[model samples]
Target: MLNHFVRVTGLSQSAQMGALPASYAATSPNAQGGKYYGPDGVGNGALGGYPKLIDPHHNKVVADKSQWAKLWEISEKMTGVKFDI
Candidate 1:
């Protein structure tokens, strides 16, 4: 599932942005960490820290849409990739 997403997303990105700068594409992706929140919907409000996420409501940070949106904003600025979704 994860691999599929990466593949599809990569294809979509390529389709939209055309060929990526080889130098930039060759570097490690910036997926290390980002601002995150717990399942209880509380966070430090600062960006760039992956959450330990102990809240019972959510098993992982992926369930947090707000955080994802902010992360998406950061991603757009850094990668210059845009999507209609």
Candidate 2:
């Protein structure tokens, strides 16, 4: 499963917050932490780590309530063949 993480940068005076440019890691995201912990491959907190997961994908869908148009207008000023999603 693809995990999402944002790169954070800043300093704070808190145990929760370590040194500046803290490696606030957010990995091997277990959406259902504790409630459900998957399998691990080897050593604790190791890279190439596990908890094997099968990414679930939803059907490609377009919402109806959205105001944005289906096709993306690449650029109003640019002249080129624009691709649509």
Candidate 3:
């Protein structure tokens, strides 16, 4: 997931590390006009790994519906648990 994020965002690991403090600061209560932190921020830090895994821009899990179906098929075979997805 981290690799995917870095590739799509074109940010080096060090650059990502450098941005962490600012990300935390911006999500602070005072920085956000006293509202609680939310998932609407601009950078990936807003929602952490969730954005890395599920965000449309970063998601490379499957290219299209056929691949998605194939993934579920493999998973079901491995786990012996059918999924509705």
Candidate 4:
């Protein structure tokens, strides 16, 4: 699953935005122990510590909605389950 996500999104496999120890110090006050927190403090925040694709110019290149849809489609096909997304 991680492989597919990285491939589809063109994201780095092991270089995430907030995965470094230094990033923990920049966490929001609402975060618990410098970890991400979702609304209502239930689950991890969306895309926590997820790597982003960087261009040659050091600019961040994010996957568009179509790419996200493709990822969801691939996931559904692999899992044999339907996703509402």
Global CA lDDT computed for model 2:
0.31
Compute each candidate's TM-score over C-alphas.
0.28, 0.15, 0.30, 0.31
Clashes of each: 1, 0, 0, 0
* Pairs in steric clash, model 4: none
For model 3, the run of ten residues with the poorest summed lDDT: 47-56
Pairs with backbone N, CA or C atoms under 3 Å apart (clashes), candidate 1: 35-48
Candidate 1 C-alpha lDDT tens digits along 1-85 = 8879867654223322322222223443642233322222124312212223232334466577787899999999899998778
lDDT of all predictions: 0.44, 0.31, 0.51, 0.45
Candidate 1 vs candidate 4, TM-score winner: 4
Worst 10 residues of 4 by lDDT: 36-45
**lDDT measured at residue 59 in model 2 versus the true structure, 0 to 100:** 20
Model 4 lDDT per residue over 1-85, tens place: 9989877874543454445423443554433452422222112223334322223222223336676677778989999999563
The best candidate by TM-score is: 4
Worst 10 residues of 2 by lDDT: 3-12
C-alpha lDDT of candidate 1 relative to the true structure = 0.44
Candidate 4 regions exceeding 4 Å error are: 1-61
Tell me the lDDT of model 1 at 17. 31
Off by over 4 Å in 3: 1-61
Sliding window of 10 residues with minimal summed lDDT for model 1:
39-48
Error of 4 at 22 (Å): 16
In what order do the candidates fall by TM-score, top score first?
Answer: 4, 3, 1, 2
